[model samples]
Target chain A: MKKPIRLINLGKTESWKTQAVYHALAEEMTDESPDTIIICQPDSPYLCLGYFQPFDSIFDRKNVELLNLPVYRRRIGGGATYLDENQLFYQFIFHHSRVPVALEKAYKTMLAAPVETLKSCGLDCNLRAVNEIEVNGKRVAGIGGGRINDAAVVVGNFLFDFDFEAMSTVWKAPWPGFRELAKDAVKERVYTLKQCAPNLRMRAVSDKLIELFPKYFNRPIVSGSLSQKEIMASQKTAQVLTDKIFLNDGNTDIPVQPRPLKISADVFIHNKKMFFKNKKINVSFRTDNDVITRVKVEGAVEIEKTIIGITIEEIEHILNSGSSTVLKDN
Target chain B: MSKKDYNFPADLHYDGKNHMWVKKENDNIVLVGIDAIGLDTLGDLAYITLKPEGTIVKKGEPIGTLEAAKMTGDIFAPVSGKISAVNAACVENPGIVNDDHYGKGWMVAIDASDWSTESTALISGEKLQPWIEAETHRMETQGFDA
Candidate 1:
């Protein structure tokens, strides 16, 4: 007998609630609680950070605040991403024991529905290695999953449109040509529905997912609403999800490097010189227990004040900000 | 250790069912880790979450989770016991699960309350090689790069 899984469609919600809902379901679901698959879209754009990533290292805090873009940290592990209504989210919560114990097996098994759905659309999308759906060598979706309490939650996006400019603007990439690098990186990796077929409505793609999930998982898909218990739990979880303390958790400043360099644990250095877009930045620095300390920078005086600390994040910030204009004018 | 180019360290006891390994640390403690076949098949581990010390966990219940660049899954406790300690290095740098799974990649250690009875469930020595071979064949059938 196929297990019956509840399907909840939260049409559109404040961005943070999108993450909170699935997290709450994962925490509250039991063997008795109906297995669930949620479909929703964010009402506005928000930056969602990976579980272990530090906020300071991943985002230009000053730029994010200046732009008034809200940020939330999800309990799931992955890199930071910009989320908006242009994408549809599917969140699955199942009893942990019911899922495959092997991580890769679970992904290949659960992600079949979406892969099948994309194929139905006449695109040869493959669930590419390491958590992405690729079509003709370009990524079409981002997938990530992790266990939250007794339930294992897998979350992914069906992208109708992507804002490369907004994405490049928000990510912390401190260096000259970093924004272009960010944009190029996205173009190299991701493909939006608009890029594929502008006429395809997101609703049609979502409907395809709804139609195929039951068939692929060998489960009955029954339409349902959140019980009162889930609503209350989700509301409480949303509060914590939006809290600054939760957002700030695990974030630390990463030291800046102009060029890629490998420093082993055994090697120690007090001074070094590196180039940022061909400009020499002489560095004087010390380390305490491998953490950078007492840093100074000479050359590139236009951005020296912002990068004297010598963290990758700081240099990226200066480089990412208006550094290109400074470089051009210099 | 290098039969068929897959690591099945002879000293470690194998949980053929779950694909985890057990190392008897002392009279009361036993260390748990994912074997090399598991490490290679799962790809690089990006995040590791283990139950905090002093938590009582049952045999077969999940004691932690491992997230890789591609997927995420639970780490089941092989014995019913109290989690005495977890690998801090694995938590901070999860790649060790792939780079050095047997040594620095050990997940957690338990102060077993029922090791004498529970350990009989685990297989060691000649038993592990065959079990690992079976697992590799199973992974190849599933389209993994085993």
Candidate 2:
């Protein structure tokens, strides 16, 4: 017989609490703890950083301060993202033994509920690659997971809506034009539930998830609230999540190349400035499934069209082939 | 007993539960890294962070974290020791861990405090093949290819 699971439906919570609740649960979990799922939405906006992402390298500190957004560094790994009430979060905290040993299998297992939930809402969505939920090649949900203490935590969001402008402004772009490029790339690649299903409500998505999770995991669900120990643990976890030292932990060294911003498993925006024959050139490009889909070149327009359909490896070969005139005739 | 898809080098000592391998550099100093099966299971690595040099860690405690595109997990120490040094190259270019996990991709160097006792727990030599086969079957059930 399968073990029973606990379900906590926190309709809305303070931004920090939404993140802290799951972290605390995972920290306090033991072998005997029931596998738990918490559904919640942050009452306000906040910036969440991946466990290994350096805050200074990924975010425009000035813009973040201007917006007065509280920054929280999650133990889970993924890129930094903006979160608000528009995105309903589903956090699953299970003992390591309960989840699949393989990360790919674990993701597919946990994400099955959300994917089915989206499908039930009359939207066509499926788990693409490992963890992404995409609708017609556009990503509809943001998912990330990792091991915390003895618990395997998978936290993902159902995007009722997304603030594209806030997302664009918060990131640290290499050049002034890079943000606009990123903004366009994300808008083109990410889809919201409202954009796909006009009448769907956040409550409906949460309710559907509650109904499907037990079926997927083959476990009976028991409606519950945070235990006294979990509440105390969350209070302490909140303090660490908001600390500045934790936010800047990943900034130990300056990155050599500005890392590409991954919009999805298959989409990324790369911005780099390189020297071509002593003339500095700014190159920004977008790749869809490893093939260059868009290109912007400040120093040479001819090379842009030539490299549009190629992979980054082919472009690097052309740039590093000891031929300064590679772009002259293109 | 090694499978065609994964490599379990005979020279290294493995903590099968944690998926870490240890190579003794000296009587007490050892280099540690994720085994081939662990690397394959993680898919492509995106980022990695190791504890700073000189941090004391107990056996089975986390020395750092490895982050792939979709998942992240702690890298546990196979034996109790102080982290003598961290592999800066792998931390800078995480892809190297996928490229050369046994050599330049080594995660950390530990100055072990109790190698004589702790080393016995790690699998090697005659015990290596059976451990790899068991782990392969275990992971395969969870959807790993091998």
Candidate 3:
């Protein structure tokens, strides 16, 4: 007989709380109960970037603020996602020995069940090489994970119910025009579960999940809650998440080499830096990349890159005008 | 229920503290970084700063930090001794803490002469289940339950 997988919905709590549960579950599987696969839902509306991405690029400053979001990153790696009530996250906790040793293959195989669920919703959702569920071409679901003793827990977010306007606003590329371009680029490629399954409300979507999950695993699905231990772990983790120095950090010395003609910002400093000229400004990049390093004013500030020249003008106006900190009155 | 499985590796060495083990590399120490259950439940790595090289930290002392985007975590020493080397790779890319938490992601290395005191808190392979369970229980009580 197959093992019964547990399904859980955080149901409108802070996004971090979802992570707290994941960690808690991982710990539980290892020691207390090694028999269950757990799923979760997160709270808040924000841009969640991949581990390899610099947050500034992943989050759209203007759009994020308009939504009054708490822009933050996650521990796993993958493309940034916009999560709101529009999305319901599902997580699977399992032992590695129980899974295939091949990381990439295992990730795809694990996500296949959800991919099918989304497909049933009517969208042309497709899984990609890295672990993204895309509609047409734009990603509707982002995935990532970690390993517990002989175990690997893979987690992902599905856009069952979400606000595209807010999502379009929160996520953007480093390139200013790229966002506008990407938006258009993504227009034909992406569609939400609501778009595909117009009749699927939050309740309906969840109900489908509750029913279909068991069939896929060929096992019973359990309705569960946080044990006393997991609650304590999340609380402890939450405290750590709130710390400033811990949440915002930087190690600028690790040389960053951006692509040619591209203006990549490394946030070890408070002033945002664009590769405008041969002269490198003495900007300190913050660890979070939300703030900037000081600007490196070189002799005449020659334009080594051409495109950013156009960007800096608009950037200057925004900085001079009222808004969020841009290179901070240097 | 918060599941805690020791899943500690058989090959890695330990430093005192609830943290687990890692093997020593040529000039750098490759640790599992943080245990699986440790970083995940804690949330994102908002900011993480390890003790700079040459800092003398006793075993189990606060060697550095592991911050989630929404939380803060202490990077406890994995060994008791003087800090001989560190993984600069992590200061640059903390996700390595997640990617290769135990392998390439090891945090720091200490040249320990006293294994009894510094290594006492560490566990490996089959021995890590109980503590993992304890930590999971701690998380469960704190709203980590789904």
Candidate 4:
């Protein structure tokens, strides 16, 4: 027998309302409560950061303060993104035991509805990676989730329109020159629905999703509204989300230590984190003009400017050799 | 243990519905952790946040939140108690839950405030065997095994 699901279409709401309501609904979930699907769009612009992401690591606090742009952190795991009214948000909240237990399989199953909706619109989108949708090798949508009380929520978006400049302003590169390339990368990697259809309305896309979700999930969708308890809980959550202290909880000042900075536009440092014998080793290095420029090991020991002109592969080989295992990277 | 294996030691008391195992460490303290089936089914772990060290937790109350890649599950107390200590290693590296769930991944230890009353609600021995096997079979039918 098909299961029952409650559909809450919160058409257009304040930037925080979309996050607050779904979060509150998830918090109040119990075994007796029906599964839920929330669809909405933010009316204003805001930068939403991931739960584990440190603010200063991804965004410039001074620029955020100067621009007076609002920012909030979600209890979800993923990178930050600039969200506005153009992106239609869908959050699927259900009991953890009610869904597939495998992570990759679960995400693919839950996201199939949105993917099929975009496919019907002639976007040729497919669920790629574990948590993203791709069209012609470019990401069209992003998905992430976390647990709240007894519910597991998988949240995703339909990218109706994207603001590249606004996105670049919030996301910071490790250094200058790379920031411009990073912005260029965003334009190169992400695509929007309007890029395919000349005059597709956000409402039309949302309607398609609403129509298709029932067929994909094989559940009867009964339209519903927030309960009184959910409303009061969301109001309380909204207050907590907008609090300034909550936003700046992990803010830190950058040290003036002389670091090997990115000198060229093409040189990009990849922060690779590996777990060897339950110990985390983080390595940061970049090739400058086809030559290894600098190697820095952070978060374990102070080995700054200790090794240079050696390729990352050679460093890996030496590290793996297990003879001189003194420097552990960040 | 095999990916399809179901192993709930007979000595450990379980809140079967919630899928938690509680092992009495002393007269008043009990060590709690998610069972192998729960760990195997919950996908890879990303983060685990436990209730603060000294907070009083009620039986069946959530003591921590576990975030897998796409889904999140709660870790509940099997008995009413005050959290005496938390596993620092598991919080630092949550992968241990998948790698060694029964050993190093033990989540918390509670100083049972009312051990006798709360302990009565837990299941063990004969009752736990059928419950775990049925739950495992149900999960396997849903395509959860690695």
Which prediction has the highest DockQ against the true structure? 2
What's candidate 3's DockQ score?
Answer: 0.07
Clashing residue pair totals per candidate (backbone < 3 A): 7, 0, 81, 2
Best candidate according to TM-score: 2
Better of 1 and 2 by TM-score: 2
TM-score of chain A for candidate 1?
A: 0.77
TM-score of each: 0.70, 0.92, 0.56, 0.79
Question: Candidate 2's residue-wise lDDT over B1-146, tens digit each?
Answer: 34446788899999977888999997699999999888876888987878889999999988888788778888899999899999999988989999999999999999999999999999999999888888877766642111
Against the unseen true structure, what C-alpha lDDT does each candidate score?
0.71, 0.84, 0.53, 0.72
Q: Is candidate 2 or candidate 3 better by TM-score?
A: 2
Off by over 4 Å in 2: A253-257, A276-281, A299-303, A318-330, B1-5, B142-146
Better of 2 and 3 by lDDT: 2
Residue-wise lDDT of candidate 1 within A143-232, one digit each (tens)? 777767778788998888887777768766444343443455465557887888778888898899999987788778999998898888
- Every model: Cα RMSD to truth: 9.3, 3.4, 11.5, 7.1
Q: What's the CA RMSD of model 4 in angstroms?
A: 7.1
Deviation (Å) of A11 in candidate 3: 4.6
In candidate 3, clashing pairs total: 81
Tens digits of per-residue lDDT for model 4, A94-185: 87667666566677767888989888887778876576787765677767776677777889898888988877776555444345545655
lDDT, candidate 3, A1-330, per-residue tens? 545555665666777776556655565465336444545555566555443345443455676677776544444433456666567777777654455333545556577678777677666777764466777655566566655333357777676655545655565434333344334433434556666667766665556665676665555777777778778887776554333332333432212222111111111112334332433332222222232212223332332232132344454565576443233332
What are the chain B TM-scores of all models? 0.89, 0.93, 0.73, 0.88
Model 1 Cα shift for residue B65 (angstroms): 5.8
DockQ of each: 0.18, 0.43, 0.07, 0.36
